[model samples]
Target: MKVSCSVVVFALVFHFFLVTGSRSPPPSDSVIIIGAGMSGIMAAKTLEEAGYKDYIILEADSRIGGRVHKGQVDGNTVEMGANWLFSGGPKSSPAHEIAKKIKLRTLYSDYGNLSSNIYKQGGGLYEKHVVESAFKVADARQEFGTNLSKILSSKKGGDDDISILGSQRLFKQVPKGPLDLAVDYFYNDFEEAEPTRISSLKNTFPRQLMEDFGEDSYFVADPRGFETVVHYIANQFLSHNNNKITDPRLQLKKTVRKINQSKNKVIITTEDGSVYHANYVIVTVSVGVLQSDLIGFVPRLPHLENELPGENMIFVTVTDEESRRIEQQSEKKTKAEIMQQPFGRIYFAGEHTNSTYLGYVDGAYFSGTFRSPSDSLYPLLGRAT
Candidate 1:
């Protein structure tokens, strides 16, 4: 999966105001949705169900289904992005509901399953305690989340200024044994996608310390593609008949480049110079792409600390060749509130926005459905705060 940033804006279009709770009634003005990925498609589906038909989905890629991507190894199915379904709690997630409806086969990769095979980095089988100890590292994990929560609870906090913590810090205490090394290697490797350094731990904690797998996640290794759920969603609107879906509402290869809002209309300029006019627009792209300035907002979006790349260039920047270190960054920065909030008439949705599930497919879904109207927050697409 590629990471890119995007910007969505709401146009005033005169002194008119529309507010229904946080949502307003559907109007004839067409809605332009950028990206055909999970959040984008899901957003479109919601609009379609609400008797709103004047909306169009503009996707940058030739295909839809953004992070819910599947890969092939010798023709065998493999997940390229977001490989698992995490249950938020007792509540049946949309992914679970869809899986049950479609009878999608899923394999449970519980703690026992993961802890069973412990492979060392260089050679030899690593001992089990190291793996077990990784799960028991609650003290270290507790050192990170909201500083206020910690202070209120009288809990000692980690460094305040730091926003991330590299798992390498934990490695310093453990013995340099193969088993210990393996555990450290596996965790640090995976956490490379997320910087271990922490400024506020209220938002996240060490994954191993939490007994959350059963309550939150399941691996999808079915014979069918992992993205089958995305297919089911597309079928809801895009699919005409059982197979052929030729909905003109869904336009592919339309990469949004700029957004300029007038009093009533929002003008969207695509990379190909194709101009689209709409009464409202919903931009759903990645945090990275949004930061990369792939799509420009008329009044300009907030200032981001870094410039991220599209799928084509993520790896080059994420890796640290000199120290052989993978410089993982925490997805949502400290100042994500600025990233999320509604621009003018545009709304934003993506996994980066939902702090409840944060980084999970559920976050993507939550942001897509939860942020109905005027509730335009782009969190990761920014935290709702």
Candidate 2:
């Protein structure tokens, strides 16, 4: 059945000393941040750090924490999305620092003894040794992107850094043998996307950049509930004086129907017909939402109307019984028993992304900063039309 509810609209405008007389100034030359998800919150925090306090965050959901949803399931807290911090060292990880500052705990995964029970396609369960041997064969048979390597190593250069078509070509170069297929599955598993569909340039360039930064393979260490991290960040914005930061910003249960923007101000219309305005607006809605036109833009956002990144989402779930079974197995086999399950777009983050500690709290924390944007503002405006 279709259900509808009226959401209470609230605006908390954080006023600075620059504003003279007006209680609610006519959309001052301040910034308005849309969505309170990780990107949005980080954007707001970045602005605050940069000494900009006049901005307001508009959240369509009834609560903050966009993809970082967490709750109790079978007596254990589980994250619905965004679960682990990858390579979150002090110098490179903002999410990790935030967690430390807020006193959040983390659980580490032991990958050294990782052992997975293999369920073959033909119904029989293979021995762990057999599966490991197969995985190694698959790894060896995997074809590297020579074409991409050539382009990256070239002088004249190509149109875009990477192309979907180029990635598709590289995938085709690898033979469709069992070993090749296994390798493809493994890489695709981590990417959460089909090999042919993923961005070859984007993936390669990022790895190259990381290498330049002295980072080797990806690392997943601390895992914690992502929701806790979100709440911790949100608490910072709230003032200790009256427990108020702005005038009560953050609207829940309200879906943005359309956005009308001009150089002077941005007017956001909710699904319920109510309208809200701000001086400058930062759009942090998901690429999926944008692709579906769930939120419309008036005078239309030319640059953001049609184009979006080629990223997919993955979701995962684990029960207490399952966790126990793995622990027991780990003890008996003297091998780390962990479950690595991958789903689409809706990732189950917070201590569950790794095989060593699937569905643990740290998974969500690790995932929060995985694809974190460099500058929140740049991501908002960087979408191509």
Candidate 3:
């Protein structure tokens, strides 16, 4: 897949308007960016930096930062979503850069320590050598799966639909005893949020977190909250007072109910019965939201098809298959059905739309900042000259 930033988008749009020099759609021929999450805010920032000011951000929630949110617990701030700032790769993620710029406090997650800390069912620590042996076997199994996946991928016109479970069975590495099961759960279900029975070996074998962003993961421990990075990004373009966004361009508590589009402009209707018109729109809502009937489209969108918790606190992350089933009834191949292409004047931006790093914070940031001209609605900006 081609990789590009969102800056190319609004820059082209600015050039489009300037070169055309058309003032026909009243002065209100502006841009409307839906959602105040990472992607939306970054898109707005890119627009402002490109000298495009006639834009508004309609946020469904009362606060900004969408899924990157926080909760108050015992008079202390705690992150409820997206706490890890991945920053070890050769390429720096924008979110990690923002965290550093703001000097946000973070703690390196020593997942490597898990082996030493492994405990048996009785709450007694497992024998050190036993733990080491289990991990060694597990690592070998992972390597076997990875190598097998590569072989399967390289085969021409062959079914690469091997499940992780099948790989484990073929490698004779199926976890049987309680100790083995514990290690297997930690190695597989804990991370994928799904058992190996349903997850594709090709997809699960190559750990994207380590491969894409490197091995380091820093746990955000800022008193100001993880969303502070988002606020800092917002402050760069929007007005703020007392650490709160006061920009009139950012409309909060506005749940978009319908999006009506025409050849020349797009109309957006909020849940509060307020209507907004714009020349173009950037939709940063999640894939689930798009699948649901929560927002109606006058002309139906293209039929592209379309975590977590834990802790001692007991947060359940539903399996990916189960989540997809709940959101979309049909069990069809989801990745193929997902069409990131824009419909009419609406452009889609979010982590889910990002092919390389989907379901990741970096993906959301990158998608908001850059998109290839082919995948984006840059051509729709009338850049013909």
Assess each prediction's global lDDT (C-alpha) against the native. 0.57, 0.45, 0.71
- Candidate 1 worst ten-residue window by lDDT: 8-17
lDDT of 3 by residue, 110-168 (tens): 87877678777778898878888988998898899989987986665453558788999
C-alpha RMSD (angstroms) for model 2 = 16.7
Error of 1 at 356 (Å): 1.5
Instruction: Tell me the spans in candidate 1 whose CA falls farther than 4 Å from its real position.
Output: 1-26, 113-116, 129-135, 138-181, 184-192, 198-200, 206-216, 304-340, 371-385
Per-residue lDDT tens digits for candidate 2, residues 1-385, read 0000111101121222123213342323566566777656655665554455676676777667777776677777666665544443334444555665766555553333322544556776656676566555444433335345445545332323444335545555543555445545554434433343443443332232223222222222223466556767666764433422343555566677777766556687888888877665655555446557787766754333323334322122346987676545433132111111111111122222221112222322322222223212223222310
The lowest-lDDT stretch of 10 consecutive residues in candidate 2 is 1-10
Per-residue lDDT value at 298 in model 3: 79
Q: What is the lDDT of residue 4 in candidate 1?
A: 16
Compare candidates 1 and 2 on lDDT and give the better one: 1
Positional deviation of residue 296's Cα in model 1 after best superposition, in angstroms: 2.5
Q: What is the lDDT of residue 67 in candidate 1?
A: 85
Between candidates 2 and 3, the one scoring higher on lDDT is 3
RMSD of 1: 9.5
Q: Work out how many backbone clashes candidate 2 has.
A: 38
lDDT of model 3 at residue 150?
79
Q: State each model's C-alpha RMSD to the native.
A: 9.5, 16.7, 9.3
